[model samples]
Target chain A: MSSANSDTPTRILESTLALLEAPGGKLPTMSDIAKAAGVSRQAVYLHYPSRTDVLIAATRYQDQMLDMDTALAPSRTAANGRERLDAFVTAWCNHVPKIHGVARAIMALTSTDAEAKAAWDIRMTDLREGCAAAVAALARDGTLPDSMDQAKATDLLWALLSIRNWENLTQTCGWEQSRYAMTIRAMAVATLTQDTGPLTDALACPEPPA
Target chain B: MSSANSDTPTRILESTLALLEAPGGKLPTMSDIAKAAGVSRQAVYLHYPSRTDVLIAATRYQDQMLDMDTALAPSRTAANGRERLDAFVTAWCNHVPKIHGVARAIMALTSTDAEAKAAWDIRMTDLREGCAAAVAALARDGTLPDSMDQAKATDLLWALLSIRNWENLTQTCGWEQSRYAMTIRAMAVATLTQDTGPLTDALACPEPPA
Candidate 1:
């Protein structure tokens, strides 16, 4: 593809993000997005076969622009399971606030709009894989509690890192962003693994002198 | 007021719930509800001045129908903090599935409809109070960790009990209702209290031989 041709998809995705983050929380239709991108509706449809396709692509494009891979590298390359767990929590907790605008937009549409639901399910499926990888690291290191298998551990961790949980902590509870990340990291470590690391240790109540 | 006059509000609230739970997840306007209840729109308005008021009343009416007070009695009457925590988790987790339909409906409308948002906020505020009460019990019993304040602990517990989390666990992850309740209860006890009781103990990995 020529340079000019290549720029079209980029423009479309950027316009998609801008419209999604607009004040009203109204979902942008194909024609709306195409108009914002200065392209014809047919051009938008040519690149993305359907609205769900473009939405999913736009979200992925946003993540790329945000350097999600770089943010995830520490967790991906951690030396041990506990470190991996901590890194993952920190990365995800921090990332939630950044993607929150678009995430919330898509999430709000999931109930009534099938296309939006499709985009959301795709994103969540990817996130679940990350959770699975973290839990697998714990299992490989023998730090995961024996009673909790890898699947259940992943499920628990994924639930813990939900965007809604972050929204509740930071928005509804009025917690600082750093504190939300710290507290969630501590909670994840305490509940998911047998790591008596400093973070988890700090979360434990003192035993009365036995 | 005559008995017949008082029955109008009950009929309106019941019809509101029926419409909310109907297929296709379309939000019911006052006229739709009045039609369902076999009352004139003016009669519905006589009982509820706005759609928001009726939505709120309907949810509380559903709770009464479900005997929420009876479900909560065990938690309210628990002898100590630990027992209260466990009872509260069990009660709320079990209740989520029963109320999932209506909860999901209100939640979907929150981003777009101010009336729905008002209803959701009221329900969440009530839930936060339950979380606060549970955390206060832990603090009173001196089981809350030194590093975490009661407010923060309550926030964590409230986030954990979110209906979205329940939907993810039981619907997305396909966990059994019993497993979701048991796992969440154990997680709450393990992370929120210093209790080394059976549930928390079961969660810990065996320490390496010293």
Candidate 2:
């Protein structure tokens, strides 16, 4: 592809992010994105074959804007299963408020728009993969409760850290962000794993003997 | 008052419920309810001082249609705090699927409609009261975890049983309703109470050793 052809996709993704981040923004349609990018709708279409692809790309763009990898690194590189769970919960809980506006718009759109659903599905699938890895780490350490199914434990962890659950606790129930993170980390540990002797050492940011 | 005057409020409430229950139903405006009730707009205004009042009344109408009192009797009559928690979880979990259609409609409306939010607020306040009572019972019985403040414990319990959380576990995570109820009961007890002793006896429908 020509340099200009490559620039078109980059420009389209940038425009998509700009639209989503605009104050009080609604989910921008393909035409809206094309107009924002100062390109023809056909140009936007050429770069992103479908609206879902563009939205998904824009979500990734937002992640890049926020440097998601750096944010996620502590969890990704944690030394053990419990540490991984804590870091992962903390990273995700903190991430929610930063990305919440775009997240909410995408969620609202998903009920009616298939493209939005597809975009959300892709994002959640990625989160669930992280959750599964955390569970696997616990299983490897023999800290995963023998009674729990790996899949079920993953689902519990994912559901516990879900954006909706976080939103409800922080927004409606009036929990401080730190408190939400700490409590969720504690709760996730309690819900997903078993006692592997002296596991407290691995539970970073323990809440003062509570 | 004439019989017609007395019957007007009932008819208006019935119309409101019908509008919400209809497939793809939007939150009916006062005018829509008035039309559905075959009454004048003035009549609707006379019966309900505001749209919020009408919607709130309609929600209560749904509760009555479901005979919420009988549904709640088990929780109210539970012999102890832990049992109260279990019964409450069971009642609310089962109630969600039964009322999900209208519950979802009202939730969708809450974003754009103040009246829908007011209605939701009233319903949640009622739920919060139940949570508080359960906590109070635990505190009274000397089982409330000393580490947990009563208010915070109530918030945790209420958040655990939130409709969104239930929806995620059942719909997205694909848990059976019974499993969701059982797990939530276990998690709630483990999260809220102090004792590791003799508590399983109070956990109604305990999943056998799993």
Candidate 3:
């Protein structure tokens, strides 16, 4: 494909993100996106057959733009299960504030918009996989409590780390973002793990593995 | 007040709830509500000075219709701190699904609709008071951990018992309502209290005082 043709999709995705992140934004329609991208409406139609396809593509584009893989590498490559869990919390909590505008827009639209719901489901499914990995690692290392079922533990972790909880704590209760991050990890350990260490100890900064 | 005049407000409130609870529901505009209530648009205007007034009145009406005080009486009357905390969880969890449709509508509308935001805030403020009472009870009995500041503990419990968390656990994770209620109480105790009992033990049905 010509460079111009390749750039067309990038321009469209960039426009979508800008619109989503704009203050007091609402879901942008196809024409609004095409206008923002400075492309003929036909160009948007040619590249993505439907608005849902655009929403899904825009989300993935944002993920790539954010270099999410590198952001998650610490957790993904942790030497131990607990380290992995901590790394995951650090990475995920740090990512939430950065992406929250678009994330909130997508979530808010989900109730009435099937396309928005599908786009959000795709993103959430990816996050749920990471949560499952963290929980599974705990089970494999025998750090998961005997009293807790692995499946239930994973569900609890996922719910506990949700963006809504983060929003409530930081936005509603005015919690400092760093404090929210530290507190969630400590709470997760207390609620999900068999580890007997003091809850405060769980908040100790994780050292980068050599 | 004449019966017809008093019934006008009830009709409007009932119409608002029905409209809010409808599938794929959006917030009903003044005219839509008036139409649903079978009253002239002028009648709605006279009864509710503004859309926000109507929204706030409708939320309070729904609370009255649901008898939220009766629903919360167990927690208010619990015999002890732990029992109060457990009663709070039981009452809140059971109430969520029953009111979720309208609750979800109010939340969805909050972004663009300042009136909806205010209405939702009123409801949440009440919930926060309940959380504070639970945390205060724990402190009174010395069960609250030294590590858990009472203010932060109230915030954590309020966040933990949020409708979004309940929705994620039951809807996304497919946990049964009973299991969701039981597990949240257990998680709240583990995370907020100094209590070291096995989590499952927290789920043993709370016996109402004779």
lDDT per residue (tens digit) for residues A1-111 in model 2: 112444778878877777776775666888998998889999888878887778777777778879877888998888999889878888988998888767876776675
TM-score of chain A of 1: 0.79
What's the DockQ of model 1?
Answer: 0.38
Error of 3 at A64 (Å): 0.7
Model 2 ranges with Cα > 4 A deviation: A1-58, A196-210, B1-58, B197-210
lDDT of 3 by residue, A1-210 (tens): 112454888889888778887876777889988988888888999999887678778778778879987998989888877888888878898899878877887887787678889888888888888888988888889887776767777888889889999999988988888888888988777776776656545534322221
Q: Per-residue alpha-carbon lDDT of model 2 for B46-154, expressed as tens digits?
A: 9778876787777777788798779889988889998887788778878877776567667766755677877788778888898898888888887776657777788
In model 2 chain B, the worst 10-residue window by lDDT is B199-208
Model 3 interface DockQ: 0.41
Residue A201 in model 1: lDDT: 61
| Candidate with better TM-score, 1 vs 3 | 3
Report the candidate with higher DockQ, 1 versus 2. 1
DockQ values for all predictions? 0.38, 0.25, 0.41
Stretch of 10 with least lDDT, candidate 3 chain A: A201-210
Predicted model with the maximum DockQ = 3
